[model samples]
Target: MNSTTAVTAASPPTRSIRWALASLSLSMLLSSLGTSIANVGLPTLAQVFDASFQQVQWVVLAYLLAITTLIVSVGRLGDLAGRRRLLLSGIGLFTVASALCGLAPSLELLIGARTLQGLGAAIMMALTLAFVGETVPKDRTGSAMGLLGTLSAIGTAMGPSLGGLLIGEFGWRGIFLITVPLGLLTLLLAQRYLPADQQQAKNTQVAFDSVGTLLLALTLAAYALAMTLGRGQFGVLNLALILLAGVGAWVFVRVEQRVTEPLVRLAMFHDRQLTTRLIMSLLVATVMMGTLVVGPFYLSQALGLGAVEAGLVLSVGPLVAALTGVPAGRIADRFGARRMTLAGLLVIALGCLLLAVLPISFGVVDYIVPMVVITLGYAVFQTANNTLVMADVQAQQRGVVSGMLNLSRNLGLITGASALGAVFAAAGMRVTFVVALALIALACRCARRH
Candidate 1:
């Protein structure tokens, strides 16, 4: 075929691209759904495994650790390889791992399977935005992102209620079992309908940076461990891990600068807009994760609500985010990302401020109102912020950028999980909200500078 004909065929058709998005969304939903399912299932898992609460916590920790460690390297791998191949392979791995997780007879085996599930999720999370953005028309980028974000929110919202029902009916393993069928369906749809890969020339030789990959993985893993263990003043072990992470990070940067094919582009760090968005992503994750951890306890303790009642109250946020995200995406496309981001931050700050001064009252509205406001603001902010992060990046680097975003999220998660326990211990639950309010306000100020 002529060069012109080849180029034309390489571009995905609109209908097929939309199908790919649908499949990708399902894939994304499967990955994200696991993130929160374990949160609700932790207690049931403990009972089933005959383990302590802390021991069973490894089920969730293992997954988060694996995803955070490999995401950056895996993103670069996707760029060099055929993303279509990697994406489909990820779905397969996740499905197989889900089965393993369900069948595992011990806590150790379940944790190991959960780790594999994280590997699968890292592959999908790294590629989702880049794959969809590359496939869709530029005019529809915002809409596609909105749709993707909506599925993610839906997955998170489904986890608690779904896990509760599944565990109650079929035991703790039921949560993992349900994903098998849904994942199989998504795999079939993706394999049949996703666009063909446009690989590099067969004669060209490209090398993967094995050393840099090792350094990066060590750096991220060490850092996550240190932060997660830093529940209070860093102990001797935590301090040592933190120092090891610092050394690994320094070496990783040095290695990336020297490698012919670096795992991450050092120059991407120089892009002001990208850097700001990545930082904010980390901050947002920390605040949101901490709020999620603390909120349910606050509701039950403060309002004397049941497990079901607290779950219902927590549902309001994801519901709002799912409802608001697509419209926010559309608005970003029309009015520009910067202005929309500023507006969203202001709204979030307002919500946070309200929560900071929340009255001790019988009204459930006190908790429900701020949760909805913050989530709506978060949806608007995310719609605009995500667009800006990708605005200055190359098509090839989009996968890596997505990984960076995900990396920040995991950092925030580990940070929130580790640090907030200390705060709650020191200042009590309502004070935790006050602290979150302060952080949100700080993030709002940072958004203004951007």
Candidate 2:
């Protein structure tokens, strides 16, 4: 074809496409920012509410709980109701919740708003990448995922630093208010630029298994609460509640097996490749979250850095992960996902091992190198895992597949953080890292078999 003919044949780009992508990127940032941005405000929040350490921890915990509970359900809802429509609704709700959080006078009000904010966050988090997968061309999906991953990393890395600055200058309320204008801007863009749903909401009938959902939520709550109290001062009643939670979790799995439209498809376990990928996703996320929480504690305690400095140092992992995510995705696509995945697990193991042995005198360099290595591994692992999960599934089962994957990542992170926190409390920081390294090694072994 002639140059002129080729030019005429090529698809033209529209302003709306740019706007849609921009809006989606902002939504990702907002969702991630909400997760970590509150970290720096914990002490201030505690002071304002005259709360205990455990109570103040809820400022972060509530948000995680809400996200974990709602992500899969919201993702399924997005498939049923139209991803674009749900995306806009979620952004609006998130914005409103942010405003409420900023205005909250009491701890109860703040926690309530944060919970609502998590609901909104779940909507955006579920649909944002799914939208990209559907809207962007196949060739561009990796790039888009990479960019989204980068934005997510930046938001997380910036969280404590940004929150500290805002809290320092304007108080704890500023953390929530900072998201308002950005959320509103993203909402407006989404409304105008996001394409109409390819699938109409009215045509889809999705019957959510409310019983299964309730059981699952309780399982998570019980487990989280038990882990929280396991390391703290607790009464006999608390131990009984924890024991009850263990029983409830067993019930949850049994209930799920019998349900037609189960909360998590038990059949997914039959595919070793898919199962390994899913397990890797969960294990890596768990390690990442646990490491993120404990790293700062050690940095502050052993190194004597302030909150802001500690946050910056700890953010190196996410930053490195973000920076390398796209290239990692491209490499995964070029090479087979299995090799990339195995490599990622090995790299993560190395990072964890490094962290396990660091000396007391080590500073930022000591911290950044291992985190960057681990993050590089994470970027590769996540991209490969996502690709693997979607590879063999039928189009109709995409919702189920995605939902399970989302749930696994969140649940793993929650459980990992809680369990590791208890370990740190019991065995000291060094032992926690050692345990994390061992887990990563186990995950790597699992990945190798795939």
Candidate 3:
């Protein structure tokens, strides 16, 4: 062999520009598919396991809670270790967990398996963005982020339909089975195509804040419990736990201030831009995520659609969201996140207005139009927020910050779901949508000022 050939063979090649983007897209798609696929399987799992509605709800809740809680922690951890290493480990764990979930005989076992799968998902998501940051060229970073957002949106959009089909044909196990090969493919692609960019952060002396992590987890858990249980359901013991959690959160804040390397950097909130943008993102996710739960129920119950049909229609928003991500990110990079976010909020408000005004006998076109508009708005808002969040932070801090964003949005989703559910029970879907629209309008005001 020639000397040049020999040299090339021995050394790692520089990343092909497209490969990094391709890898990022694939990883995100695989990770997102897990959430989407599970939603479809929920009904089937409930039937097969003979679970009550409340018990079956845990199947979705467990997954969301686990991923939401652990994502930031895992992201911070990935910085100390290696993104690639953590990414691979997460993929392997997720794949195995998916397989286990498929085989689970009992509802309890399935929930447990799903929780493990969520842990893996947290790792994968944390690394995917960090990986993009490290690997992609500066000009292309926004586009990459956009594409990642889009893929995730697509996965979410497709989730119900995919789950419905698989459940219909092969049973609930099919949902878990679907993720297995896709995850394996992602792992293989990552191994081959991912850049060899492993720049460990300099402060090896820095340690993870384990105490703070535990306290924060407790705080969120307490809040979630309070919301889920409601005041009526909470016993004396549950009330005490909630109080304890409040105390823990206060302690967590104190502990975080003292730590050299905190799991959540309290200082990031000091920036007006970062802080306001974060609030907007959180609010949007909360309202939008909550709306999703209502959509399926309304379509299936009030509109007389089958589960599969309802899911398919429900997927429209997410699909549009995914498709819009890259373009939104690109625009944010060029014109600034402020404008993109404002426009998105406005569009979302409009979509909600459309939903509120729809006739009692409105056809598919009526619903799909509003859903698509809302999703497109969601894509723009999310992409812009993501870009802005990462823009000011240094490379070394990206993982932790990224994790923080994930935590914020998930918290919003959890809160929205619980709060909106309560609202739905007390009032009605129409009132809930109208109130949510007003909230979105408030968010738009915030976005405009920001």
Candidate 4:
């Protein structure tokens, strides 16, 4: 039998499928947790290492940069190699790196270890989604996507509080060390339960695209640095980096078009549906980041709430997201992903419009209500969009496509952090949400067309 038939035949039983999904969900959680957990420990790290804020921030930036630059490349590598094997390797690497991070004696060593950990995270993030199609029935793909989404949000939401507690109990090292046991558990489950790769024979027929991978990685690095450096203040250096990224992207595209086994097929962009979904993902992510960038300031500066109160209020969005994710996926599975995608976009647009127009005199309730709407909508949009994108992709291409989906979201987050944060700083929350509204409107239009 062929690979497809083999994959179908190898589908895990119900109990095994649950174990496999648990592994995938934990993988997603660990990767996302790595992203946010370190943020909460930056100040502690600065104090412990006697490093300046600028130097210590690299602890977070190094991880972010590594993941952003290498995610797509690693995903393509998994497509060429066996995903199960690569994913197992990734989990092991992450676990070892986490231990190194916890034991590092110098700040530089910690940062270097974090970069390694991020590489592992890049693999985990890319492959977990790819594995869904292999592990789950086609009709349950939406539910699987939703569960991953929910775990991701939980990880993000849990990071700050969990990191704080760990730091208080065991110091900054605890934050990194906390994931070690979880990583091992995930590795064990995945190894025993996930369907084995049947593509080793086919893999021998294709050559890995080293040139394309390198060019893409370098281009992504330049772009991420351009968007993340300067602390939201655009400067000559940022401009230069942006220009470098543009040039690198042009070169990469040319290389991709020539490579026998391109990292990303240039022809994929020609698919209107895929292109549209990617754009919508980017736009929605940008708008979602706006709430994160603008929410705290709006709560504190505008409404005069204290830090703790503001944090409590801010947590509501992620809470709503976690609650809504599974239901949203089920809805997508039942009603259709395309329709749910459009509906979700429209809901987000309405919430943004309300945030922009509502009077401040209405106070915290006004903010909370709209944010709940936006978060709920975002949960639905994310699940439906992911389901729609992954549903039709070829099995061999799922890893790369999943990586692209993630890459778009990362770019959007970086852009929003820099661009929308700047907008809020200059023109205030109302204007920022107005910009967000415009973005969601564009996303809605794209969804409609799709």
Candidate 5:
């Protein structure tokens, strides 16, 4: 069958489409929830396990590192195998891992379980976006993307509060246990509603690139560790890891050029549109991370807000993102994706500028209002940018491309936390936001050139 016929054949009825999207949204939510929920319980975990802060931190880091290292590999695997089968397996693995995390007797065991959970999350995050192309109609792609974005934001926004409530009521284990039922529900929906994977000719089957996968995973892990270790203090170890990551990346690229079946085709970067979108995604994510890294300090030190007040104020950004996500997607559908992408960048720049210039005397409203604008723009940009990228991807390459997009965002967040947080520590809130503004400006320029 031709591509058009295959898509038409694969596209379910409107009702089934909604159900499929629901399953995908839940997948996104669960992955994001896994990321943010564990953070709140770190102190409790340290106390419960009688471990040092550094040891307890692995509970969060293991999950993050697993997702970062394996996301691209899993996405490629889904492309080779079947996204539906892999995604079902991912959901099951995540559910089982969560149970294991809750039942673990030691901190080491919990971290190991979290690693397993992160692998599952990596699969979910990678495939959910890829599935969009298969499940949703072309015209409504932005709306579907927006809905997924909304769920992701909701997961992030609610995680800390939900985790706190769960920990308070049922202890740290509850945070992990709570998702088991949700995971089962999501798995059932996905199995029932997601379209079956299309069959490929036997002659066309390509072997998985184990060497490339290993190199890429190792490279990413090294880079992530470089950025995260030492609590933002760049020491000799961080420098060594960074150099190692650089060398690994070079080796990975060389191997991909020589391999018969590469994990990621280096030629994909030659597409200016794809390259620009990935760069823009990374820059935007870095800027967004600035808000997370710098906002609390700005609130507490600059605005003199207490911990509770600062947290409440900080939640505004994700809340705004969640609320605007669907509407932003609908707007992207009405307008062109490129135009909306540019608009979103500009809005984010404006917010950054306001954050830089607005006086401290204006108090919390100043921060909150600008944050609302920034997050709203982020919602629009993310939905439109994702729609723009995925809308044109070849059916066969969707999974890998989706994984690449997510990897860019993850890298950007890691970079922002380390780099932007350093700027905040040294130069204070105003300078940090100025740096954010510059990053957004660069993103806007890239969007316009594209």
Candidate 6:
């Protein structure tokens, strides 16, 4: 291939760009689907491994923790190494992990495999946007991003139901195996149609932040481990893990201060607007992810529904988000993002309260109604909340801020699933819902700021 035809960040031929976008979108959808779909299998996993619901939740918690911790580091790695090379490696690793997960005979093995899967998912997420911008024409980049966002919505909406159906027929292993062929297809298209990253002057000169990476990873992983195990009792193991997290955080801050190129810029926190946006994102994620993890258990165990039935009921929230997201975007543009965010958080609080206070004798429809309401609130707030963050940041820091925002989101997912799982194990589902409601109300207060 001549230099003219070689895919570089600056420019590439138009003929194959469409295929590249499609492949990238598929990768994004695959990562998004990991959270939505795998959640449906929680109940089945609880039964298969003869584990408590809280224990099986490590399946989800470990995955989110791995992704959240590694995502920004991977993004930096992709730049130092080739973005295309890292993307391919991620896809390959994810494919292998999925197979391992399918064949795993024990819960511990499955959680370990899923952590590897989380790494793969993080690599894919780190580069998808950059690749899209490099490949898609700048003039039409907005349209391309919109398309990818839509795919994410559709995948989120359909994942639980599809996963439910897969598990019901083929068992939980089917959920992991289903990605194998699709992953292979995407890999082929990406290799053939995507451009290679051309070695650049900047990449050659910059040193990778290995120390910062280790410290941050330690901080996140230790904290995640502590929360996942801190359910009913204040055990020695939990306390030790928590102490490790504290030490890691302290070391991380010191390292970040000394590093030439830190993983996160502390100066960015000076932007009150940006910090608020990130907090709001975290709150929104807690609401969404908490419901997703808790909803299926309440449905399958409490309401006497099967996995397929729970999935169908759980899928409605995302479906409603998909239906309302675009309209909400338009409304945000017409009115304002703050108003939409406020309205959305209020609705979410209301939905949480409804779920927490509902009579024990409630039916399937009762569960679904609150979920749809919450989902509608999510769709309404997401665009507005994101717009506030992106609009506030300097163009130079957008990439960093965006990564932090996403990291916040993944943390929210873990918080909802793991921390709340512990609460569920000790107190019960309604109490967990009440805790989430409190978070939502606090987020609403954050939204009220400038």
lDDT of 3 by residue, 1-450 (tens): 322232245453455546656766777887788876776566677788887778887777777777877788888887776667778889899999999999998899989999999899888887787776666555455777798998888777777777878888998898898889988887887877765534445345678788877877778777666655543344676677679778988898899999887888888778777788778877888888777867877787778889668766876777678668888889877887768878888888988888888875877776888888888888888887787677556656677777877777877876677777667767767887887798899888887777
On the 0 to 100 scale, the lDDT of residue 295 in model 5 is: 89
Q: Can you rank all candidates by TM-score, best first?
A: 5, 4, 1, 3, 2, 6
As a whole number from 0 to 100, the lDDT of residue 242 in candidate 2 is 78
Q: Model 1: how far is 182 from its true place, Å?
A: 1.1
Model 3 superposed RMSD (Cα)? 4.9
Residue-level lDDT of model 6, residues 39-120, one tens digit each, is 8799899988999988898898878888888887887677667778888988888888888989999999999999999999
Tell me each candidate's TM-score.
0.93, 0.87, 0.88, 0.98, 0.98, 0.78
Best by TM-score: 5
lDDT of 5 by residue, 1-450 (tens): 534356677655889988999999999999999999999999999999899998999999999999999999999888888888999999999999999999999999999999999999999999999999888778888999999999999999999999999999999999999999999999999999988886772224789999999999999999999999999799999999999999999999999999998999999999999999999999999999978988888888878889888889989999998999999999999998899999999999999999999998899988999999999889999999999989988877888999999999999999999999999999988899999999999998899899
Model 6 lDDT, full chain set: 0.76
Residue 341 error, candidate 2, Å? 1.7
Give the residue spans of candidate 4 off by over 4 A: 1-11, 200-203
Query: Which run of 10 residues does model 4 get worst, by summed lDDT?
Result: 1-10
| Whole-model alpha-carbon lDDT for candidate 5 | 0.93
Query: Which candidate should be chosen as best, given lDDT against the real structure?
Result: 5
Local error of candidate 3 at 405, Å?
Answer: 1.1
Cα lDDT tens digits, model 2, 1-450, are 322232235443656566788898899899999998997798888888999877877778788878876777777666666777778899999999999999999988899999999989988887776666554554455556667777888888788788988998999999999999999999998998776665445466766677877876776666666555544445676677678778887998899888877766777689898888778888888898888768877788877989668766776777787788778878877786668878888888898888888776677677788888888888888877776676555434445566667778887876676778778878887798898898888898888777
Model 4 root-mean-square deviation: 1.4
Report lDDT (Cα) of residue 229, candidate 4: 87
In candidate 6, which residue ranges exceed 4 Å CA deviation?
Answer: 1-21, 36-62, 79-85, 99-113, 129-150, 153-173, 189-204, 230-234, 297-309, 326-339, 356-365, 387-400, 418-434
Better of 3 and 4 by lDDT: 4
Range of the 10 consecutive residues with the lowest summed lDDT in candidate 6: 1-10
